[model samples]
Target: MSFSIIFFFVFFVSILFCFSNSDEVYVINTNGTKIIGRKFFTVFEDKPYAAFWKIPYAAPPVGKLRYKPPNPLRWLDKPVYNYSIPYNESCASGRTEDCLYLSIYTPIIKHIFDFPVVVWIHEDAHKHSPDFLIDEEVIVVTISLRTSIFGFLNTGDEFAGGNMGAKDILTALRWIRDNIGHFSGDINKVTVFGSESTAPIVASLLVSAAGEDLFQRVIIQGGSALSPADYRNYNFEIMNKLYWNLDGPFEKFNRTKLYELLSKSSTKKLLVASYDLFDSTEVRDNQRLINSFPLTVELSGKGAFMNKFPLEVYKRKITNNAVEVMIGYTNLDSLHKLDGFVRNRKLLKYLNYNFQYLLPFEGRRDEYGSKLYKKIRRKIMDFYFVNGTVGERSLRRFAKYMSDQVIYPILRQATLHSQVSCNNVYLYRFTYQGSFSLVWNTVLRNLNFSGATSGDEICYQFKCKSLSTAYNAEETSNERLFIKKMARLLGNFAKHGNPTPHSSDDILDGLQWLPLNPAKSVRLLNMGRELKMIKLPEAKRMEFWTQLRNEFFPDRRINDEL
Candidate 1:
């Protein structure tokens, strides 16, 4: 036989062999709609589990449906769904625009019923696998949502009410509520997990009235709605820029014209224009990170995701009040920011001269040279940099400044939630340094950094495909033990709404993670080599931010001014 024929024969045989031991499983929802899944085993532990992949939660948002909220998928005639097909073919022949599917992985252990569910929301869902969480005997889910222009483009009018990404998540949650029970999942025990970019979305959900009673708990990492990059208010101006980039006339470009141009443009054209706009846009000092189409606040609309700023929602006590929360950041979460300063000397020199640019605009976007802005800038430079010079010598200080940009918003959310809500709010800081750190191994490998960076702890929670080989090589190390402990903590939270509900739990080393204390010092759980409960790390820096907020912007507004 030819070499190509031999390879194909071997591949086909291997595929058959993989599924030989597996069996098909069927579930019927409350509406009498039946769906098919498969029972399989984990790669590492060989633990039996069931997976339902490419299950449609909403109709495909294609053509005119682009930039619009997801429409709930209708199951007419109680159709029987065979979702065991290949991933690409199941998602409408692998079209990106028609990829609104969710995959569920549940433990099939004997006599085990109603496993707690964890719905993971992230931009890159392909990199994650349910191997580790499934071994923990929990039902894990990952959903794909619209992103970039399709997800977040806001025309500030009814045509494109904005925040389609958030709307997609809410829709998926509603679907889970109606159908997850058939998959042996406890809908009441749902916990939404968001890491990095998705963290802000979860934060927004926590404060949006439309998200009430959707999920009972949330775990946020490395991002928050309080961050400047969380939302955009200049909707019309940004839409005009996008339209002009597409070769459309900018004159008289109202929301109607903008909507017409966007809806008629091909996906390829929209994607190219979005890429060019994202690439050429200049970063503002107010923005810690630049995102092309961030979430937008809808002042008035039917079924609006967010009708006001998250801060305002918190002040009015009109958000979800009963959901437990676990929020934190890595010790060196923003270490990647140092890579730019290390490579570009001129960028550092300019920042040293114009130090005010380092501080977030907060409520002072147009007040750069104002006395209060200058004073706050001077204080920040004095604390983070000596002699007001930013160079290689101040790299660590710069990292701290950038890290605070991430830490402050997250910590602020925790404290604010604790003050208003009646549920327990747990806080943690991931400080474990190991060979499997995602940000280090991928980008800042040569930096010689000593702590975990942003998204470093996700691999320990899930068996990411890209890092599976490395994880296998270190299967026998202390890191493996740490992974078990982390999983236990998370699983315990999902099961009981508390990480350390029992004092004698050995996997956690009997450490009791205390919740945030609005009346006193903010308690924190440090997830380092030795797991322990301690006072917040860098307490002085947190105090400084608290004092700054009280001194200049006590309102804690999410806009340019209170």
Candidate 2:
């Protein structure tokens, strides 16, 4: 046989046998409608669980639907056919825009209606495989939705609204409520969780009237609605400028004209245009054109970002009781990101030139630089660095300043707010080092420094093939034990609303994970040779930064003032 024919025949046979040999099937009903699903092996043993993949939860947001709120999944009379969950196709090519899909992985069913659901929401990134926690007896879901310009672009008026991203998440949760039960899952007892960028999205859902009724628990790791400033007042001036720069004729120079041209462009075209304009735009001290772009403010419309500022949402909720919350950050989450900024040999000079980049802008840079900014900077510098230091000392201080100033304040604020409003909050710091060192030293060759950076601990939750290779036959390391142990704790939390199950036969060995105390403490996970709770070391420094941030931004104000 020819080589081409041989290859094609082999590929076809492999695909056919893979699906037919090891597949578990079931039918689920939603509102008298029936849909089919297939089960796959999870981290658990021989007992396999079910999965319904690539299920559409919303109407496609294309053309005029762009920048508008997502409509719920319009069902058809005929039952829909689905295959094993495929790789998330949303933004799959870094361009496709119709990715409003969610997949459910339910544990082996003993009873049809007996399991808590955990919904995963993140921007752009999606986990496409059979999920973890199948053994923990909870259903895990991954939601793939719109993000970037496709989700956030907006006009100040009602013609084009913003925050389509947050709205998409809300739509997904509603779909889950209407349909999750059919898949051997619980709808009312859902825990919504997100890591890094998506944590803000989960945080926004906490205040949402529609979302609040849907989910009961939330887990925010490394981001929050209050700390990262999730939503901002839409700047009409900036909006107009964005359209003007979208490779359209700007000589006519009118918002309406530019907006029409933008609306006509494809999602890919607009995304490309954004990239070009984003780099050229001179960002303010506090924001990046794209990175710090917050969910759009919708003052009088549907799901407005608390009428103006993100802080407004939190300020209003301080008195209102909310759902259970688990919030935390890694020990040195922001350090690696800061490494790129400290390339210049003269560290102090680098700071003088880029201190604005390192810190969130509380006021205009000119106002900040000309006044008390220096005194505050001096205090920070003295704490993190000696008056004169260079090379190794300088590098370590740079990392510390970035971690202590940029990351910790936000973490402390989120944990404290959750405790006050929700009454139950758990804080943690991921200090596991051994799991990540191999990836850094060999795979990435990042030899400069190593510790728990942002998103480092996520490998434990997702079945990462590369990380798994770190443990082959005959290797029992602390990292492996911690991963399994922590997974049990987190999975137990999803199953029982508490990581340490109260049942006498506690699966997690009765690990007593205490909640955040008056001191705003955190339960340290994999800290050096020990895993225990510690009073968050940065609380004092965080308190100082929080006061400083409030003085400049002001909880009542929408924008910063000198």
Q: TM-score of every model?
A: 0.88, 0.84
Write candidate 2's Cα lDDT for 1-562 as tens digits: 9975686567445544656553455555566454656766664344577777778888778777766788786654544444454545664345667777887788766655768888876543343343456766778888876776677666667765777777788788888887776777787678888877777677665555556677888887777555434455666655655666664445555777667867787766777665534332244334322353457557565565344444555455542246777767777766556545445445545554555433442333434465666665565555556763324347655666666633553564455465456456777777666654433334324545546666666765655555554543345355555556666766766766677656353444555777755453444433444566677666665655656667654455432211
RMSD of each: 5.8, 6.0
> The CA-based lDDT of model 1 is what?
0.76
lDDT of 1 by residue, 293-329 (tens): 7887885658888877777787778768799998889
For model 2, the run of ten residues with the poorest summed lDDT: 280-289
What's the CA error at residue 448 for candidate 2, in Å?
6.1
